[model samples]
Target: MHCSTPKTSASLDPALLRANFPIFGNHPDLIYFDNASTSQKPFVVLDEVCRYHTEQCANAGRAAYSWSTQLDRAIEDTRARVAKFIGANAEDLAFTSGATESLNMVALAWGLLNLQDGDEIMLCQRDHKSAVLPWYNLKDILATQGKTIHIKTFAIHEVGDYDLKSIKDQVSPRTRLLAMTHIHHVFGLDMEVAEIREIVGDRVLISLDASQSVGHIKVDVAALNVDFLSFSGHKMFATTGTGGLWVNPRVKDSLRPMKLGGKSEATPEAGGLNLKHKNTAELLEAGTQNIAGILSLGKAVDLIDSIGLDAIESHVSDLTVYLYGKLLNLPGIIFAPGMGICRCEAGFGIMSFRFEQISNLDLSFVLDEENIFVRSGDHCTYARDTSEEYIRVSMHLYNTKDEIDQLIAVLEGVVG
Candidate 1:
């Protein structure tokens, strides 16, 4: 199926695009608004995964057989394709399980090796726990080894973006790294990464969790100039357990492998075992990878490329504006901090809000009964002022204005 928008720059046909996904076919009335959590798989990605299992079921880089060689070539080709998709070199990207593992790798392999006593790492308090917890874990692990590392946190502005002033004020000579997100999972706003680089200067390493922005927006690693970038494929229409981590070659040598297995080379010496680990992106890939999932991720990249990020962004932006306008009309509705005031201008297609009288959990159950699926929780964030949960509605290219209208109608009924 041709998923691309018209050359005349017309809006995408969500109804037509929805045909490519089998989930909608199974549940025709289902309204999927929790796209930030994970997107429904397309037929192409599913078929690619099945093809790999059926045609050539062999381990990558294991043997000299035809199946192994074919699998090895496929994996390398996918590595190059996925790297190019994010404007990066193949040598700088490594396949991982997902964003969680990728972020953990940065903490264990890079942070553990490079950081010293009194070196501080900066993190955003409102970011996801996956991005925040790994560093704190590193701090605890280092303390046992007698190295005292300090963790500093910065706050976000009312517009759901990083507080540039807060970041600037916190940077010190001992600040080694700043871990942040590309697009906030709950706020849906782009964190303005380029501005962040200017504030922290050239000395501080920036590690970005691009879980929400990789397939949703145009991400150029060179332009962002971050030391490390991580994202999950499941959130981008690929299977779970497939993701990529891109490391800048300048900092490649600073990362020590956290895990070593079959592929890593070592030789016996008179003194000890001499470990030979390549200083490229493949240094961390020590075990057999998720071969089928990685192939599906490559297909996901192909599908996204055919559709074009510009068109996808435009379609989702229009949906966000429509959804935000309708939600504003709700009688006792309250948006998350900085969300209502932004007026759907800064972010991608994500919104979190709640009603004055209705409990967010109750509303989620009600919506689920109505076949409208939304996420209701703290969204796995680290720092929140209230324990109250909010209803999150995230959209994608396959979502339609009609679906948003149905959600608003249901919400209005509950309010009335």
Candidate 2:
């Protein structure tokens, strides 16, 4: 199918962009379509991480040495870069191991403070395990304290897109928090957060899990008016073991740090040591951070900025639309009529589908045989689907129209 939309080529040539990623050079024939799981890192990002580890490896925010100072500076620089990427202040962003840890920090912190008997926490059914399990664990903890954690779900219609009307009706005065993923990992659908805020207003605190959205597209916390946002670097072509949380400055004081450690201790000189801490990003960061990973994350964000999010968004939209069209023509391919289409104010490079004639795992194995990599199963979503019948194809900036054509040809040979 021809893309009728006018194509706007990126400033960075597709070949040069592909060359930046080391994985492509290593396996030139590999068609990686599982970016939603984790993105392949560019040479710049890999070098940044390697440089920190090999030349200037030291702990951050502690001690008084040149290496330590360098480490501290790099970490701070990364924080600033991440903050700018999401249109937030550096003070509002806290480094975590990854999106899972970031989500847990806020969910557990808020759950400890606000949850009580008969309080409900609103969650959408489309959430990933990283976004959903944190709250479920908190619910268990709250239950032991004579609090029965109530759950209210926002339904995804039969077509797999989120139904905003369900969210509007689920939110109530007793709702303590509303946890939602900005992008649905399985279907690649996005939510209208502004509409959500309009429907629920400030009556409920909103936490946005941008694990699949953040790096693939632009995220503006101020514009979205969300209380919290979580994202991971690995999903954005950076090294693993790096992610962050953006907390609204207004609620900074209210959120108690769940992971307190060396950096978390402000006053160690006083007779007995103080646990009460200043409400800043440091409070949530806790220990000596992942210096190398953080720097690599910053480099990845810089690379994205250099390429431009507008170009990335347009590239992915067209690629997914093309792939969706091709998949529809293939026999046994099952996807929503609006499968490749996204309703996000901003979209990403992702699409998901199912197969009626073959098992998803078997289909994935067949694709693997052809040197194609795609993700199958619920994609780390335990509550969403138990069967491994769902298949997802997630692309990135390095991907091109030819790659989609290759994927379609391979699938046609295998499944058709």
Alpha carbon lDDT of each predicted model: 0.87, 0.78
Residues 71-92, model 2: lDDT tens digits: 7887888888889999999988
Q: Give per-candidate clash totals.
A: 0, 0
How many backbone collisions does model 2 have? 0
The CA-based lDDT of model 1 is what?
0.87
Q: What tens-digit string does per-residue lDDT give for candidate 1 at 150-211?
A: 99999877656677888888899999999999988888777778888888888999999999
Query: Clash pairs of candidate 1?
Result: none
- Which ten residues in a row are the worst by lDDT in model 1? 1-10
Give the residue spans of candidate 2 off by over 4 A. 1-12, 266-276, 336-347, 382-388
User: Of the candidates shown, which would achieve the greatest lDDT relative to the real structure?
Assistant: 1
